[model samples]
Target: MAMSKFWWKSDSSKDKSIHWMCWSRLTAAKCKGGMGFKNLRDFNTALLGNQAWRLISFPDKLLNWDPTLSYIWRSVMEAQALLVQGISCCIGNGQTVDITNSPWLPSIEDPFVHSDNKAISNQKVISLFKIDEKAWDIELVLDVFEERDAELILSIPLTENDKDTWYWRHEKMGHYSVKSGYNVIQASKNQPNTVDNSRFWRKLWNLKIPNKARRIQVNAQCPVCNLCDESAIHSLVTFSFAVECHQFSSVKQVAGDYHIFTEWLQMVFEQSNNRDICIQEDGLEQWCPTSSNSVKVNVDAALFTDPNRYNYAIVVRDHLGHLVQAMSKCSLGKVVSRAIRECRHQRSP
Candidate 1:
């Protein structure tokens, strides 16, 4: 009597076989390979760090404090701190301190001292500091600077006086408010000149969209899919395929009717994979026959005069050189009819 072998009966044996198979497949040809395995704990730690950095770098986007605001104050502050720290490190022998104390170092003397040790007298320092503070106030002056720079670059109709007036008006106006009397300062220490008022009205009226409103519009839809839900690159590239598949399935009645559509959909989905499965320039099709199945599947890209449109066709032929089933015209009817016609033709021959 011959001894019978139960190969997968033992857990340890099965586990070992599975492990060996996995590694063997990974080292296989690029076209026929398994997922390359990584240390799970290390990967998880790296992923967690990436998430933390994203959160820190895009606080407003992640936190949803004000959906209408594009700039994240906290993130910007963090970035500024990072910049100051880096600059301080480069200039000050790797010592990290407050921006004011380390690199900025305001002088206790009649004049404040810069990192360069330039002696700016108290009165001169105070005046320069005030002007510099106003000019460098990122939140207050960025919009003004951008607008003026754009006008200058584009060669828009504006004189030096007009530009100065516009700047002064913007300084007086401060930040915008959707409230009335916000711009009307009857009298103040920082009152704008009459020329500034004239430029202010012209520029303010010309403003097509408010930054806040623009931000709101931009954030209304998901960045990836342009859907209302949370837009993620993974969702658009990966999960959306499943969603589109489900949508296609809902419309398709027959099983194999969706084969070509699914294949095309997958090609579109995995486009980032950079593996060109389309028919090449030589007009040759990718025809590979499998021994396990007598039927041969031919995948080819259909060409049209229009370059913008992408149309693909997949055909499955029976072992007897007959088309048992077919789908075309973005519907199941054409393929089914083709299949029937081929079947009848085979019978007749």
Candidate 2:
């Protein structure tokens, strides 16, 4: 948070106070309702955690260096402390784990702590199990721990040769990343999300009120229908021209069944591969084909005049002119790499 203050100070000489929302609020998504800025403190923490994640993820891949060579190794050891809460050990061979001392146990509550004084020093967790039977030594576990702890420990799977590995529990897959870790940390906070983005869709549906004319003092009414009091429902359904369009194409649309414009449009437009759209492709440039075996990405940023918001759309296509992926999202934060990364995730399976 101090870092945020320092940057704000450096950016201005006078009138330094941010006129809009505070830095924290601005970090929220516009749909959840804020101006959309990155929370620096959380972001920095995630980045540092990611660095530590890399070190642990590939133990053999780490570079060898002496403490006299650099202070980087010391920094990593310090950062590992923050990551402890979010990660857990995936018991593989279970050799490296100290059963009583390690956080490798699953139970979150402080139930029972087994006396490790009599236990053999550096004893592998596998020693408590019956290897021949491929099962936990239930009698021994019960002696060492309460029933709850015993059951949890018994559930852990072990292999003869596989080494114990780290598991980042935050993600569905056990993979760890700074962006995903950042989002996971952010989700832990119990922030109230009061904004309803669908209200804007409702606004779009009630176009009978002439939103453009009222807001801009200009008469921007429905051009195709030519109705003096044209609404989204009337323009898309009830208009004589629209009924003619439906007649021309064999499709049934029950008027007044859809209260929201988006739902109604989805019903109309969602065909397997065949779709017809009336909206014009404004400001679209000519398309150019890519080399064979290459994927083509097309991206565009748009502004909504009424709500006064910015959004971006990403579409991926194969060289054969087939659509591979399409994604549209409200611009949450500024980073081109983040935008492209999200696009790839949304790409067609």
Candidate 3:
């Protein structure tokens, strides 16, 4: 509450200030048209959930904990449910996975089977596979499960040699991350928001201005209008001067009445003509020739996250701009061979 007070009121000291927006709205993702603020409770649960994921994924690395375990471990155990909500198992041999009990489907939202067939109640996932081939038995799957469930089951890729492994459903790399866990918690809360404003927030934040100018000083009465309370929304949207400025712009007129500053700004952006856009190119640097006897060394670097490596190249050129000495290397483990192969492939085209 105190944090929210500070965020909303820049000049707030002793006197009470009006809360124009709720804390939940303020904490919503910037994409969802709110200031992206971390919900501490949800974030804490996500952090604990990471510990829970480690226990579930690599149980050998952590010590076995009973009721005698520390409070922190107990808290992490409590957040196991939160971790469970965002993770699923990638099907492999399918021998150990229970068809109905295990979350081994390709889909993230509904991984568990909803089938109530008592005959296959205790059956394993292996039973759904074809007897002769390693693929799913199409006829048996269609007859046993619903159309949606059958499709999801069939879509799951199975590695005949590998064992079933747990994976984070939200991540493309199938790794449990704190960021993905926090987003999952945020989604579960079901915030009522429509239309993404991430681009709007980005542009607004990117405006070339001092950081202090972004903070609004709340005033009891508008200095210009001297009619109502001075807030960002009121000053920017409801004020006569602002409306007149909008009206005079290429936008022609204020499209509609808007109480929120963000909504008004978004509407203006949507209604504005793209043809009226004026591009201001920054001053470009002119290339200067090297000294008659001196050589210039040009360097370039590329970073790759897949293998966690960096590749750099250095070229020494004489005053004539002809390459004299060229050298390149890959760092952070010996991925130089792979980097060379990729660079050749890219350079070929």
Per-model TM-score versus the true fold: 0.17, 0.44, 0.55
lDDT of 2 at 129: 69
lDDT of 1 by residue, 178-228 (tens): 111111121121334523344554565557976555333346554433433
- In the predicted model 2, the residue pairs found to clash are none
99 Cα displacement, candidate 1 (Å): 51
Estimate the lDDT of model 1. Answer: 0.34
Q: What is the lDDT of candidate 3?
A: 0.77
CA lDDT, every prediction? 0.34, 0.65, 0.77
Residue 248, candidate 2: C-alpha displacement in angstroms = 69
**On TM-score, who's better, 1 or 3?**
3
> Distance from true position, residue 53, model 2, in Å?
1.9
Instruction: Indicate which candidate wins on TM-score.
Output: 3
Over the stretch 1-349, how does candidate 3's per-residue lDDT look in tens digits? 7778787666645677778999888888876667899888888999988888888778787564664767767788768778768788877787888988888787778788887777568898888888867888888988889888888887877676668789998999998889999999888887467566679888886789875665686678865545678889877666666666656554444478777878777776777767653333474434457989999988878878768888999989899888899999988743444434543565474
Residue range 178-259, candidate 2, lDDT tens digits: 8776766665663567445746755555568753453456555555433345577667666665666777554666444675
Clashes of 2: 0
Most lDDT-accurate candidate: 3
